[model samples]
Target: MIKPVKGFSRLSKKEKIEWLAGTYLKDQPDDVETLKQYWNEDTRLQQLHDEFTENTLSNFYLPFGLAPNFRINDRLFAVPMTIEESSVIAAASKAAKFWLDRGGFKATVINTVKKGQVHFTYKGDKKKLQNYFDKIKPVLLESVKPITANMEKRGGGVLSIDLRDKTDELENYYQLHCRFDTKDSMGANFINSCLEKFADVFEAEAQRYEEFTAEEANLEIIMSILSNYVPECLVRAEVSCPVSELSEDTEMSGEEFAEKFLQAIKIAEIEPYRAVTHNKGIMNGIDAVVLATGNDFRAVEAGIHAYASKDGKYSSLTHASIENGEFKFWLEIPLALGTVGGLTSLHPLVKLALDILQKPSAIELMKIVAVAGLAQNFAAVRSLITTGIQQGHMKMHLMNILNQHKATKEEKAKIVDFFQHNTVTHSSVVEQLEKMRKG
Candidate 1:
């Protein structure tokens, strides 16, 4: 039986790896070398990767790819994506190319509002606290002027602040709910800085008010932070064409293909199980772009999933329809993205990705990100209704299977070409590789 180890974190990297190998990889002599093999070749680059998060492990690599020919709002952009899963970039590029001549994607930023909250407890009187809030609203705004001045010069800052009574949810729980226009940055820091300042101002001003009783004057601050649920920060991306233009590119008519595609989306709409996976497929594209641009993909993902369930039940994020001989597919998602702050300018790859995108503003990035999701879902649905998802997905996954089996370079090339026409499966690839070895 394995026993617990002490002072593990105090050990050097080499020592830590040595202990781990002795304890866990006793049967596999070469596993330690395999782990070390993935370390970055450049010492400086490795240092940067180590500092990205805690515990300085070797870098884990994901393929960073470019999906080109994306025409959004008459401007072409080559979107960058970083993800481990294959076929996503291929599918997105295919959809972009498919729609390149058919008006491509159209995206609009409906709102750029972000949310933050300052929670506190005031126990004496609701009306009195309300009156106190009314009197100090302007002071609250003025207190954050120092923080907001720079953001204001850049055309972004706090938009509104309101006192929210949530005593019904919990005893004496009142909040100073606020909204902001973050402009071109994912203004978590900016919003949070302002909120913390607001809390300080509210507390100090309440102490100065003569109408406030001793109990009401001493408001206990629970917390102040920005919210990840920004339903108002919305962007809509859509593609439309005549139903007759939708075809299987083989023999199926356009109308028939459109019907099948709409049915696939409809099934995802009402079915919770399917909708979850369906929305995840869309996120595959959205997250890839979000990471490449150095924004918070996890927050965007949480807010989007919450929006998906806003109508009482989780459903599809992308929708499709045929109206008046037109086939339209679209997605409206809340994405709080930044093009100027966080890792955008600090990370090298993020800088390159943003520059490659022509350094769009926050709203422009929102539209582009939304288009990525829409395009990804359309490609997935197109595959689902026509050739089936496995055919393309397995084909893309074939090389990964080959690599896992330790196929030689020459063997990989030959097998890749062979699988182009033939079926691709784990067992099938293994059999083919074995046959080639014999030959």
Candidate 2:
């Protein structure tokens, strides 16, 4: 049995690797070499990556690709995407080129308000608590002025603060709900710092409020943190053209395609089962951009899914409609992204990705990210409505299948040619490769 190791973090990089290899990978010498193979040759660069997180280990890598010809808001972009999945970039690029002549994509930032909360338990008189809260609201805002000053100079800062009573749900539970405009930063650390200060000041002020009795004045501070769910921080991206314009390259006419597409989206909007996977495809586009740009994809993912279920039932984030002889496809999604802090200035690849994007501000980044998602959904639905999804997807997945079976270069070329006119399945690819080798 393996025993727990102490001071693992104190171990040097070499020592850590040795310990891991000896303890866990005892019989796997090749796996040990594989771990060291991925390390950066530049010592400084490798050190920087090592410092990114605890337990310094070899770096994991994903392909950083670009889907070009994305014309958003009259400007063109080769949106950077860092994902390992095959065909995501291809699908996005296909969709972008399809819309390039059809007025491209239009995106707008709806709002940019983020939120945080200070949860506390106060078993005091409800009326007196309300009175005291009213008296201290300004004080709560005033206490965080020093922290918000720099954010304010950038035209982003604390918006408002309100005390919410939730005693009915849990005994004596209450929250100091706060709103903020973080501008060009994701502002997780900033919002969290301000929230902690607010909690400190609120707790300190409660003791001084004479209107509150002993029980009311002693508010137990629970936790103070920023919320990932920012419904108001939204952006809308859309593509629209005459119904006849959607007929390019597909077997179905524009009108038939539009009707089928609309029906598909409507099903996603109403059915949770389909909506989950439907939205996941959208995230395949959104998350790639989010990760490539060094923003928090997990936070963005959480906020977006919450917004999808905002009406109490999880549904599609993308919607479509054909109105007035025109077909429109669009989505309004909440994305809190930043281009000024965190990994934006840290990671080398992240900086390059931002530079490729023309170094957009938070709002511009939001618009671009939303458009990626919209374009991705358009490609997916378009494929689903005509020629089926696998025709394109399995084609993109062909190389992966070939590589998995260790096909040589010449074998890969011949096999790829054969599949162009034949359906691609794992068994079929293996069978063809075996037949060729036998010959």
Candidate 3:
């Protein structure tokens, strides 16, 4: 069994790695060296990465790739994606090129509202609480002025505050529901600061209110935090073309493929199992961009999945339809992204990724991110309704398997040619590679 060590963080880098390798990694020399190899050669850069979070270790790297020829809102963009999964960028690129001449993609920002709350308990007259809230609303807003000053100048700050009665569901429970315009930020820290201040003012003012009974004045503040469920901070992205365009290179006729595509989407929409994986396909694109751009991918995932189940049952995030001889596919998702803060300014790759994207504002990035998802879903659905998914995914995954076997450049070239007409499966690729190796 493993045991904790004192001042683990104070240990020198070499000693830390030595201890970790000795304890958990069996002290494997090559594995320990491999971990050391990933450290940045520049000590300053390594220190920056080390200070990013608590524990200090070698860098964990993911491939940062680009999907070219994305045309959104009449502008061309080569979107950057950072993810470990294979086939995501390839699928997104293929879809982007597919829609390049078919009016490209269209995206619109629906809204940019964010939220936070202060949870408290009051076991007094609800009528008195309401009147007290009405009286202290301005005071609560004013209490957070110092916290909101900078954000307010950025055209983002506290928008509204309300006291919500929730005693019906949980006895004596109420919430200080607050909303904000965070503009270009994810705004967790800002909103959270404001909420804490709101809680402070709320409880303090209650004590001073002449009409408040002793019980009412002693309300207990449970917690104050920003919500990741941002339904109002939404963006919609779409692609459409005449039905004839849907047949571009597929075997099925345009009309047949369009109807099949719609049917597939319908199944995902009304079915939970399919919708879960279906939405995951969309996130494969969205999360990559969110990660690459230094925004919070986990928060984006939580909010989006919450939105997926907004109507009760979790369903597809992307929608497809055929109307008036045209096939349309689109996705509307809530994404709270920031372009100027967090890792966006600190991480080297994140800065470069934003620059590669032409330094879009938060709104523009929202549209690009959503378009990436819509494009990804379009490619996934197109393959599913026609050739099936594994054909392309496994093909893209061939090189990963080859790398595992340490295939030489020459061997990889031959394997690539062999799979052009042949189906790709692990066993089949293994057999062929073995045969090639013997020869």
Best by lDDT: 2
lDDT of 3 by residue, 1-439 (tens): 8888889988988889888888988946688888889999999999999989877778999999999999999999999999989899999999999999999999999999999999999988888999999999999888888999998898899989988988889999999999999877778888999999999989988999888889889989999999999999999999889998778788988998988899999999999999999999999999999999999999999999999999999999988888889888889999999888799889999999999999999999999999999888988988898889999999999999999989999999999999999999999999999999899
Scored against the true structure, residue 147 in model 2 reaches a CA lDDT of: 99
| lDDT (10s digit) by residue, model 2, range 1-439 | 9999999999999999999999999999998789889999999999999998999789999999999999999999999999998889999999999999999999999899999999999986889988988999888888989999999999989999888999889998999999999999999999999999999999999999989888888999999999999998989999999999898989889999999999999999999999999999999999999999999999999999999999999999999999899999999999999998999999999999999999899999999999999999999989998888888888889999989989999999999999989998778889999999999
Identify the candidate with maximal TM-score. Answer: 2
TM-score of each: 0.93, 0.99, 0.97
Give lDDT tens digits, candidate 1, residues 200-228: 98998889899988888999899999999
RMSD vs true structure, all candidates = 2.2, 0.9, 1.2
Clashes of each: 0, 0, 0
Pairs of residues clashing in candidate 2: none
Q: Which pairs clash in model 3?
A: none
Name model 1 segments beyond 4 Å from true.
1-36
Global lDDT of each candidate: 0.92, 0.94, 0.92
lDDT of 1 at 379: 91
Candidates 1 and 2, the one with greater lDDT: 2
Q: What's the true lDDT of residue 110 in model 3?
A: 97
As a TM-score, model 2 comes out at: 0.99
